[model samples]
Target chain A: MSDHHEDLPPFCHPVSTKLLFGVFFGLIGLTILTVATSALGSALGMPPAFAFPLAMVIATMKAFLVCAFFMHMWWDKSFNVLAFLSSLLFVSLFIGMTMIDTGEYQPTIEAFDINNLANVEVSE
Target chain B: MAVADSHNTHDDHHDLYDHGEFIAHHFDSAEQQFDSGKLGIWLFLVTEVLFFSGLFVAYTLYRTNHPEVFEQAHVFLNKYLGGLNTIVLLFSSLTMALGVRAAQLGRNKNCSVYILITMVCATMFLGVKAVEYSHKWDMGILVRSAFDLTYTHPTPTTEIGKSLHISDYLVYLCVVPALLLAGFLVASVISKLVNKATLAKFMMAMTITVSGYFLGVVIGIIFMNATEGETGSTHASVIVEQPLMLMASTQDDHAADGDHEDGDHDHDKAAAGSSHDGEHADHEEHFGSHPADGGEASFDAHHPDPSTLSRDVGIFFSIYYCMTGLHAIHIIAGIIALAWVYWRCLLGHWRTDYFGPVDYVGLYWHLVDLIWIYLFPLLYLID
Candidate 1:
C-alpha cells in the first residue's frame, strides 16, 4: 500500500489577464449604468426616497459582479462567503435597532415655546 | 478509456523530497502546507471585517438622527465617479481571481501579468476619482468649518433648510478614493523599484503623481474655506421658517388650507406669547429697583427668530464628511494591500501553494466596492 499511493496533483496553470481586463471594462459599463438609471429614476416621477433606493439596488448588482467575478468569491471557499454574509446580517441588525430608537425618540422641539423669551437660552 | 489508465499513481507519495532550505520540517507534504496557508489567511480576514464594523456602526447612529440632513448632503456627492470606481474595483477583483486561477495551474507568468492588469485598472479608477474630486473642491464642497451654505433647503425659503449633523461623509468619500489609488500605485512602484534587475527611470513618474494629489487637496481646502469665511453670513429668519413651510406643503391635500390656517394661528400665538412676556416683564419690574428701566425698545428692536439654519447646515455636512470620508480610508487601505500583493507577484515570490494572502486581500477590496454601491445611491442619486 505504501508503494502505491494516490495524491492530488499540483495545479500548474493560473488564470489569464485578458479575463481580468474584461472585468475592468464591465465595471466601467456598470458605472455608466448606475449613472444613467439614477438620472432616469429621478426624472421618471419617483419620489427621492424610492428613486434613491432603486438606484442603490442597481449599484448593488454591479458590486455583486465585482465580488463574485473579479474578487473570485465565487471560486473561493464556501466558508469565506459565509463569513461575509454573517457580518452583513449583523450590521443590518445593528442599523435596524438604532433606526427604531431614533424614530421613537421624541424631539425636544415641543418642550420649548419659541415665543417664551424668558425660557430661551441664546449664545452670543 | 481503460480502467488501468484511471488507476495510475505517482511515485512521490511517502518519499520526503528535500528541495530547498526554507521548507518547514513539520509539514508532511506541499498540499497540506498550501491548504493550511489558505485557511490561516481567511482567519486573518475575519479580523479585518470586525475592525471595519466599528466605523459602520458610527454611520448608522448619525444617519438615524438626521435623515433629511443626510439626504440633502448626500446630493453633493458624485455618483457617476463612485459608480465607475465600483465597476473598476469589481473588474480588478475578477482579474485578481483569474490571476489566482492561472497560478493554480502553474502558469506563473500568466498570474503576474493578470496582477499587473488589475493594478492598471485600479490606477485608472483613482485617476477618474481624482478628477471628480477636483471638481468638488472647485464647487466648495469639502467639510471644513467654512464650506459654502449653497445648498439651501427647498422650503426654508423663509428660514433655513434641513441639514444633517453627520460630518464625516464627505471626508469618507474623498479620502477613501484617494487612499485606495495611492496605496495600489505605491505598492506597485515600490516593488518594481526594489528589484535591481527591473529598476528603471519610472520611479520619478510615480513620485510626481503622488505628490500632485497631496498638494492639490491642501490648496483646495485652504482656498474654499477662505472664500466661504469672507461671505459666510446666512439669514437667520430663513432657518426658522423653512421647517414650517415643509410641514405646510406636505400636509393632506383636502386639509391644505386648514393646515395653513393652523400654522398661521401657531405663528400668531408664538408672536403673542413673546409680546405678552415682554409686557409681563414691564409690569413686574415696577416693584424692582430697575422699574424705570422697563423700556421694551431694546428687546423688541432686534428680535429675529433664532435661526436653526446654522445648526441644520452644520449637521448636514458633518454626516456628509463622516460617511464618505470613512469609506475613502478603507479604499486607500485596500489599494495599498493590493499593491503589496502585486509587488510580491512581480518578484516571483508566490507559487501555487502560497497565494492566500493575495486572495483574502482581494476579498476585502471587493467589500470596499460593495460599500460604494450603497453610498452612491444614498448620496449622489437624491432626487
Candidate 2:
C-alpha cells in the first residue's frame, strides 16, 4: 500500500528464491559433512564415544543453517539474538557446574601416630 | 434492552472509566508481557538441556573405561532407521519453518497446511522408529538377561540383510531408555485422558497411545526373539543345559574355559569386571548390590566413574533423550497452542497487523524438529 516500497531494506521484504535455494544446498552439504566426518572418525578406529562429538559438531552446523536462514535469525532483531544467546550461555553454565560437581575428588586422610615418635623418629 | 447513556443526563462523560489506561498495575505494554513469557520459555529450555547434559557426561565417563562395550553396543542401533528419522525430522523442520512463515505473513490457511505437514512428518518418524524397534524386539534384543547374548540368529553369516548389527550391551542401555520414554509418553497420555481435557488433549492422547502400543508390541517382539524355544508370541522355555550351551559355541569358549594361569586370568577377569563395573554401575549398583567386591570396587561402584569415558557419549544420549522427549512434549504443547489459535483464528482475532503468538509457536515447533534432525543421526546412525 506504500508508494515508496523501494526505500525499505531488502530484508523487510520476502526472502529471495536464490537464498532459499542456497539454504537447500547448504543443508545438503552439511548433511554430507556430518556423514563424512562420522565415517572418517570411525574408519580411523575412533570408538562409539567419539562418534557422538563428531555427530554433535555436524548437528551444530546443520542447526546453524536452519536458524540463520529458515528461522530468519539473520533478519531478526538484535534483541532476539541476545535473548537466544542468553539461553545458550545458561546451558553452558549448567554443563560446567555438572562437570565440576561430578568431577570432585575426595582424597583419603590418615591420622599420624605421634605417641610412638621416640621409637620411630619422623624421617623425610 | 432499553439501555440509556446515563452520562447524557449530566453530560459529564469526562469522569468515564479509562479501560485502556488500566495495565493490571504491573507491566508496561502487552508486548512486554509476551516478551517476558518468551524469556521464561527460553530459560526453561536451558534448564532442560542442562539436565540432559548431566546424563550425557555420565555416559561419557562410563564409555571411556568400557570402550569395547561401547563399540559392541553401537552396532545394535539401526543406522538406516535412524537415518530415515533424520530425514523425516529435517523435512518436518522445513515444514514447521514454513508454517511459521505463513503465520508471520498472516496466511492462516497456508499455516494450517504447513503445520499438518509437520505433524505428518513427525508421525512418520515415530512410525519408522516403531518398525525398527519391533525388529529388535522380535530378535530378542531387549537387554534383560545375559542369556539373551548366547542366542544368535544364524543368518548373520549368510543373509547380510538380516545381520544383527547391534551389540547385546548397547541394546540394554539404549533400548531400555527408549522403552522408559515410551512408557512416559503413554503415562502422559493417560494423565490427559484422566483430566478429561479439551479436544486438543484428546487428539494428542490418541497419537501417543497409538504410538505407545506400537512401541510396547515392538519391545515384546524383541523379548520374544531372545527366547529360543518359543514361536513369535509364545514364551516357552527352550530346554538346554546353561553351561553346556555356553560351551558348545566356540564364540564364548573363553568364558567357560577360564584357562589362563592363576595370576593372568585373575588380572584379566578383575580388569574386565572392574571396567564393566565402572561404566555400567549406574544401572545395577544404583538399585542394589551386595558388598562383596573389594573396598575399591565398592567405592567406585557407589561413585560413577565420569573420568574414564568419552564425554561426548554422555552428551549424545543426554541430548538424544532431551531432544527427542522435548520435541515430543512440544508436539503435544503445539497441539494445545494450535487449539487456542484455532479458536482465535475462527474468531478473526488475527489479521495482517497482529499474529505474533501463532507465528512464535510455529517458530518453536521448527526448533523442536530441528533438534530431532540431529538426534536421529547421533543416536541411530553414526557408528
Candidate 3:
C-alpha cells in the first residue's frame, strides 16, 4: 500500500486557517446583519412581504458562506456541489406549488376571518 | 480498470496492498475510497434536504393561508434566544469545519478539541431550545390537544412547585436507567442459557443490550414528546373539543363571503366587519394595522387571551414545534456523530490519508447549521 500510495492524489486539501477564520467572522457578521435588517425593516415601515424577502436574501448569503467555506464545498468536487444544489431546486418547486395553491384561497381566508370577527362581536 | 491502468504506469512501484490499514481492501486506492465516501455523504445530504422539504411545504402552505396567525404567534418567540441559537450553531459549524481540517492534517489532538467544542455548542443550542420550549409549554402554546388542555387549565400565574417538575428527572435518571438495567440483566441471562456464551461474551452482550436500550428509550422519549407534548396523566382529559375551531371559523367566514360573490374586492368591507366586532378589538389592534407601521405596537402591553387565539395560534405552534423539534433531533444526532468522531480521533484512526468520517460528519453538521440559518429568519424574524 505504501508503494502505491505515491500514485494516489493527495486526499487533504489544505484550507488556510486565515480563510477559515475569515469565513467564521463573515458568518457571524451576516447573522447580525439578518437580525438588524429585520428590526430596521420593520422600523422603516417595510411591508412584511418586503421584509420577508430581505431577510431571506441575507440568510441565503449566510448559507452560501457556510456551504462554500465552512463546508468546503468550494474546493470539493463539482459532483458534490451539484448533488446539494439540486436539493434547493426541489425545495423551490415544493414552495412554489404550495404558494400557488394557497394563493387561490386567499380571498376566502380573508373573508372567513372577517365574518368570524363580526360574529364574535354580535355574540358579545 | 483504473487501478489496472495505474498499476501499469507504476509497474516499478511496491505492493498496492501496503497503502494503509484504513483503506478498505476492495477499493483500488485511497483516493478512490475517499471520493466514493464523499459522494455517498453528499447523496445522503440530498435525501435529508428532500426529507425536510415536506415540512417546509407545510410551513409555506399554512403561512400563506394564515399570515395573521403566524404574525401573532411568532411574537411569543424570543428573537434574542433565536438569534443566540443561530450564532451558537454557526460557531459550531465553524468548529466542526476546523475539526475536520485538523483531522485532515493529522493533528488528532487539535481535532479532538475542535470536536469537543462543536459538541459543547450543540449542547448549548439545545439548551436554548429547551428554554424556549419550556416557556411555550408553560404558556399553553403547544400543538393540538396539549394546547387545548393547557389553554383550558391555564396553569396558575404562580411558579410550578418543584415536585411537579420531578417527573422529567424521574423519567431520565430512574425510569430510563432501570429499564436499561432490566434489559441488560435479561439479555445476559438469555445469552448464557441459550447461546452457552462465555462470561466475557455474556458481559459484552449485556453491555450492548444496555446501551441499545438506553438509546432507544432516549430516542423514543424525544419522538414521543416531539409529536405530543408531555402527555402524562396529570394533563390528560377525556374531553375532546373541536381541534380546529378557529380554522372552522375562518373557513366559514370565507365560505360566507364566497356566497356573496364579491370576496375578492371586499378588503374594505372585511376590515370594517372586523372593526365592528367589538370582541376582537385586541386582534384588530394588531391585525387591522399595517405590520410595518405597527413596529412599535409589536411591543405593546396588551396580551391576547390564549383561549380565544388557541385555534389559529395552535396551528402555528404545531408547525413551529414540528420544525424546531425535528431540527433539535438532528442536532442531537449531530452531537452523537461528532462524539463518535472525537473518540475515533483520540484513537488516531483518522489522518491525512483517511479523514473521511470526520469530513463527512462535518458536512452533516454544516447542513444542520444551514437549515437553522433559514429557520431562524423565517420563524423568529417574521416582521
Candidate 4:
C-alpha cells in the first residue's frame, strides 16, 4: 500500500441517480403518449395504417433515450457507438431490399393470390 | 476480496493503484481490460441487433403483404398485457442501469439489490408470456396450418394437468420454476438457522425473485380477464368490437370471390365449421347457401373481414410467436447473465475500475428492453 491511497480511475463513468430517474420517468411518459396517440388516432377515424409510422417514430425516440442514457452510449467510445449503430444501418438495408424485392413480385402475386376465403390453403 | 487478491499474480509490476483480485493476467492495466471488455460487448450487441433483424424483416414482409391479416389477427393479442410487460421491462432496464452505476461506485450490496429487482422483472416477463401463449393455444391459435381460432376449453379428460390442450402446457411450464422457488425458500431458512447470514440473504433474494413469476402469472390472468370481459377470449367478440372489419368488403368483390374456388375446403374450415357454437352441425349446407357470409349467419354482422375469418390468419400468429418467442429467449439468457453478475457482486468483485461484468450485462438488458419497445408497439397496438 502507498502513503496515499489514490482512487481507481473511472473507466466506467458513474451516472448520477437524479439523471437516471429523469431518463426513466421520461421513458414511462413516452410510452403512455404512444398508446394514447394510437387510441386517439383510431377514435378520430384516421386510417389505422397511419398509426404504424407514428408508433414507430415514438418507439425510435424511446430507443434513442434508452441507448443514449440507459445503455451509456452517449459517454461511450465513438467506435463502440459506431459498431452498434452500423447494425441498425444494415437492418434497414436488409428490410429495404426485401421490400423492393417483394414489390417487384407484387403483380405476379396479385395474379393468383387474391383474398379468397375458400381456397385459403392450410399453411401450417 | 482478500481471498481473490491471493490468486492475483500481477503484483510483479509497480503501479500507482492496485488492480482488483479479478483482473485477468492478459491485461496489463485494469483500464485496458475494462475497455477491451466494453468493446467486445458492444460488438456482441451489434451482432444481436443483426440477429433480431431477420425476424423484423419477416414481420415487415407479412405486414406489407396482408395488412388486413395483421389488423384482424392483432386483436387476439391482449394489449393490456403487452403494455404491462413493456412497463415491466423498462423498469428493469432502469434498475439494471442503476446497478451498473452502483457497481461503478463499488457499492456491491446496493448493486445486488438492483440486480434482484431486475431479475424479478425478467422472470415476470416470462410468466406473462406464458399466459399469453397458453391462452392463444387454448383458442387453437397456432401457426399457418393448424390455425384454428376457436376459444373452446372443453372438459378436462385427465386428472393431472397433462393434456393435449395448450393451457395445460402452462401447468407443465410452471412445474420446474415452482419447485425451484420452494427449494430456494427452504434453503434460505436453513441458511439462517446455520448462522450464514449472507447465504440466507442471497437465498431470500432468489426466493422473492422466483416468486415474481407467480406474481406475474396472477397479474396476467387478472388483467387478461378484466380486459377480455363479456367477450371472454372469443375471436368473434374481437371482430365484432372492431366495426370496420367489413368496411373493405364490396358487393362486386363477393361475386368476384365466388370465382375463387370451384369447390375447395371452404366447407371444411376447421374452427369455422365445428366451433364454440356447436349447433351449426351441417357445414356443407351452411356454406353452400351464402358465399359472402361470415360462414355462420350469427357471425356475418359480427365478423370484421372475410379474409380475416379464414384459417390462413394464422400467418400473423406465426410471425407473432417467432418475434416474441425470440425476445423471450433473450430475456431468459439475460436472466442467466444477471445471475452471474449478481453472484460476482456478492463476492465483492466490482471495484471502480473493474466493473466490466455489470456494465456489459446492463447493456444486454437494455438491448432486450429496446427490442420489446418495438415488439409491443408492432404486435399489440395495431390501432
Candidate 5:
C-alpha cells in the first residue's frame, strides 16, 4: 500500500512539489468558483435550499483534497482514516439529533419578531 | 521533487544513531516510534475535529432558526478580506506540506525555508483577522448583550480625521510585530558579531516572518479602502450622517433652494437607489449628503429602518466571532509550534528516520487550513 524505497523510512510518504502546488491552485480555483456561485446564484434568484447545499458540496470537495493530498491521507494507514471519518459521522449525528428538537421552539422566535416589528411602527 | 536526488547523498546521510535522541527508548525502532507518533497525532486531530464541531453545531442551529439574521449581518463581513485570508492559509498549507517532504529527505535547508514561509503565512493570517475584528468592533458589531450595530461614532474632529482609519487599527495590530522585528534585527546583528552563525540565521528568518504582519496590514487597509473608500478617516463623518440627510429629503424639498438643488439631487438618488449607494463622483458640491455612503451595506431597500432590519444580527456576529476567533487561536498556536520546528530544522535534527515532528506539525497546520475552507464559504458567501 505504501511506496517502498530502501533508503526512505517506513512512515515517510514524501509528496511531490508539483502535486502540492496543483492542490494549492485547485483550492484557489474552487474558492473563486464558490464566490462566483454564491454571487451568481443569488443574482439569478437561486433559492437557499439549492444555493446553500451547492456551496457546502464545493467546500467538501476542497476539504477532501486537503486531507487526501496535503495531509497525506492517501498514503496513511487505514486505521487513521477510519478514526477521522468516524468523528465526522458523530458530528453529523450530533447536529442532526439536536436539530430535530429545535423546530418546536421556532415559532416562539417568529412570534417575538412579529411583536417587535409592531412596536417599531407604533413608535415611529 | 528536489529530493529525488537524496539517494546520491546517501554517504552523508546520518545513520539511525543520529536520530536516536529524538526517539524514546520505549520504541524499538525509528519506524515504530514514527508510527506511534503518527497514530497519536491522528487521534489528537479527531478530538480537535469534535471540538470545532460544537461551534459548527451552534452555527447551524442559529442559522436554521433565524436565516434573516445571517443574511443581513453577513453583508457587513467583507468577503474580499476573508477571501484573501483563505488564499493565504491555503498557500501556507502548501508550504507546510513541502516542508514535511523536505524533512523526510533530510534536507534541513529546504525544510527550514518552507517552515519559515508557513510561519509568515500564520502571522499574516492573524494580522488580517485583527483588522476584520477591530473594524467590526468600531462599528459596534459585537456579541449578544453588547450588540449595537447602529452606534455611529462622530468622526474625530481633527484635521487628520484619524479616528476609525483602517491604518489606525492596523497600527495596534502591528505593535508586537514591529517590536519583534526590532528585537530580531538587534539579536541577529549581535549573534553575527558574536560568531553565532546558527542563531543569526534563525533570527533573520524570524525577522522575515514578522515582516509578514506588516505585509498583511498593508493589504488589509488597501482592501478596506477599496470596499468602502468613503469610510476612511476624513470621509467617515460624511458616511455617518448620510442616512439622516437621506431621510429628510424624502419630503419633496427639491428645487425649493436653487443653490442647494445640485447637492440635494445626489442625496435623492443615493437614498432611493436599490442598495443605497449613488456615486455622483464627478459632482462635489459640498454634497448635502455628508458622504453618499454608509446608509450602510447591502441593506434591504424594501425595509427602510436599519434597526429593524438589523434585528438579531448580533446573534450572527456572535457566532461569527466565536468560530473565527477560535480558528485564529489555532493559527497562533500553530505558529508557536512551527517556531519549535524551525529551531529544530536549523539544528539539522530531522533526517529520513526522524522527521516525525515536522510531519505531526504539518498535519496540525493542514487541519487549520481545512477549518478555514468551510469558514470562508459559510461565513462570507452566505446565501
Candidate 6:
C-alpha cells in the first residue's frame, strides 16, 4: 500500500477540488433562487398550489445536488442509491394515501362545521 | 461476470492487505469493509427519512385541511432567520463534504479544521433555533402547556396556569445539577490534593456525578407527570385565551379598516375581558407587556383574517414544534458525530486508506441538511 501510493482503488472516485467548489456555489445560488422564486410567486399573487409545487421543485433540485455530489451517492454503489431513493417512493405513497383519505372526508367535515354552527345559534 | 473476474485477477497483485491495522478481520478486504459500512449508514439514513416522514405527513394533512391556519400561523415565523439557518446548514454540509475529502487525501489537519467548522455551523443553527423558540414562547404560541395562555385567562384550577408559573423557577432545576457537579469536582480535587484518590478515581467520580444529575432530571420529570395524572388534570383543559383579541390585533390596519364596524365590537369586548383578567394574571405580565414585538409587527403587516386564528391554529404550531424539535435533535447528533470524528482526525486515526468514519459522518450531516432544505420552505415560506 505504501509503495503504490499513487494508485487508487477502482471504487474510490474522489471528486476534484474545483468541482466541490462549483457544487458549493451552485448550492448557494439555488438557495437564493428558492427564496426569490417563492417571494416572486407570492408577490405576483400566484395561487398557493402553484407556488408550493414550484418551490418544492427547487427544493428537490437542491436536495439532488447535495445527495449526488456532497454525499458522493452519484459515484457510489447502486445499492445505496436505490436504498435512499426507495424512501422517497415510500414517502410519496404515504402522502398520497393520506391525501385520498382527507379528500374523501372533506364534505363530511364541512357539513359537521355547519351543523355545529346551527346548534350554537339554537342554544343561544 | 467473467470479464469482471478477469479484471480482478489482473489487479490481484495490487490487492494489498496493509489495511489490516484498521480493517476488521471479519471483512475480506478494505474495500469490502468500507462498502459494508457505507451500506449500513445508507440504511440508517433511510430509517431517518421514515422517522421524519411521519411529521411531514401530519404537516401535509393539517395544511390541506386548514390552509388558512397555516398561512396565518406561519406569519409568526421569521423567514430571514429561517433562510439564515438554511444557508448555515448548507455551508456545514459543504464543510462536511470537504472534510471527508481531506481525510481521503491524508490531510488530517484540514480534515479536522473542516469538521470543526461544521460543528460551529451546527451550534449556530441551534442558536438561531433557540431564538425562534424563545420568541414563540414569549408570544404564547407554543405546544400544549408550553404555551402561556394564562396571559388572558388566569384560571386558578388550570394545570397549565400552575405549570406556566413554575417555569419562573425552572432555573432552580439547573441549580441542583450544577451544585452536584461542582461539589464532585471540588471534592475530587481535594481528594487528589490529599493523595486520597487516584486520577482515574477522580475522573470516574466526575462522570458518575454528571450521570447522576441527568438521572435525577429524568426521575423528576417522570414524577411530575405521574402526579399531574393522579390529579386528573387533562392536558387539553389548558385552552388558548385572548384568542379573538390576539387574532383581531394580528390583522393589518387596512384589513381591519374594512371590518372595523364588526371587529370593533368584538375587539372592545375581548379587550375589556382580557384586561380584567390580566389584572389577576400577574404571573403572565412579563409576556403581556410585549404586545408589539417583531412577530406581532410582522403579523400585522402581512395579516391574515382574524378568522384564521380558530382553535385549529394551535395544531399548526404543535406540528411546527414537533418537526423542528426532531430536526434539532438530529442536528445535535450530527454535531456530536462531527466532533468525535474531528477528535479522531486530530489523533491521526483517519488517513487516505481508512477514511470511512469521516465519509459516514459526512453522509449523516448531509441528510440533516437535506431535511432542513424541505422544512424551511414548508414551515416558514408558506404562501
In order of appearance, the predictions have TM-scores of: 0.60, 0.56, 0.66, 0.79, 0.78, 0.68
Write one digit per residue (lDDT tens) for candidate 2, span B179-277.
Answer: 644664666567676784444443453355345433433443353344323332121122122111111111233332332211222343223433353
The docking quality of candidate 3, as DockQ, is 0.38
Worst lDDT window (10 residues) for model 4 chain B?
B244-253
CA lDDT, candidate 2, residue A61 = 78
lDDT per residue for candidate 4 within B294-323, as digits (tens), equals 222222223322443443255678788889
Angstrom error of the Cα, residue B129, model 6: value is 0.6
lDDT of 4 at B299: 21
Candidate number that wins on lDDT, 1 or 5:
5
Best by DockQ: 4
Please state the error at residue A86 of candidate 3 in Å: 1.0
Model 6 DockQ class: acceptable
Residue B288, model 6: Cα distance from true site in angstroms: 20
Which 10 consecutive positions of candidate 3 chain A have the poorest summed lDDT? Answer: A1-10
Q: Tell me how each candidate scores on DockQ against the true complex.
A: 0.29, 0.19, 0.38, 0.47, 0.44, 0.35
Error of 3 at B247 (Å): 16
lDDT of each: 0.49, 0.46, 0.64, 0.73, 0.73, 0.64
Give DockQ: model 1.
Answer: 0.29
Model 1 residue runs over 4 Å out of place are: A1-29, A107-109, A112-124, B1-67, B105-113, B120-140, B144-147, B150-195, B198-306
lDDT of 2: 0.46
* Residue B260 miss distance in model 5 (angstroms): 19
Is 4 or 5 the stronger prediction by TM-score?
A: 4
| Residue B167 displacement in candidate 2 (angstroms) | 19
Q: What does candidate 1's lDDT look like per residue over B333-372, in tens digits?
A: 7656765665566566554444555656666666666666
Quote the positional error of residue B113 for candidate 2 in Å.
Answer: 0.4
What ranges in model 3 sit over 4 Å off? A1-9, A103-124, B1-18, B148-309
TM-score, predicted candidate 6 vs. hidden true structure: 0.68
Arranged by TM-score with the best first, the candidates are 4, 5, 6, 3, 1, 2
Q: Write the per-residue lDDT of candidate 5 for residues B244-321, one digit (tens) a residue.
A: 222221222323222232343455333342122223221111222222221122133334332233324656777899
Which ten contiguous residues of candidate 3 chain B have the minimum total lDDT? B235-244
Per-residue lDDT for A47 in model 3? 91
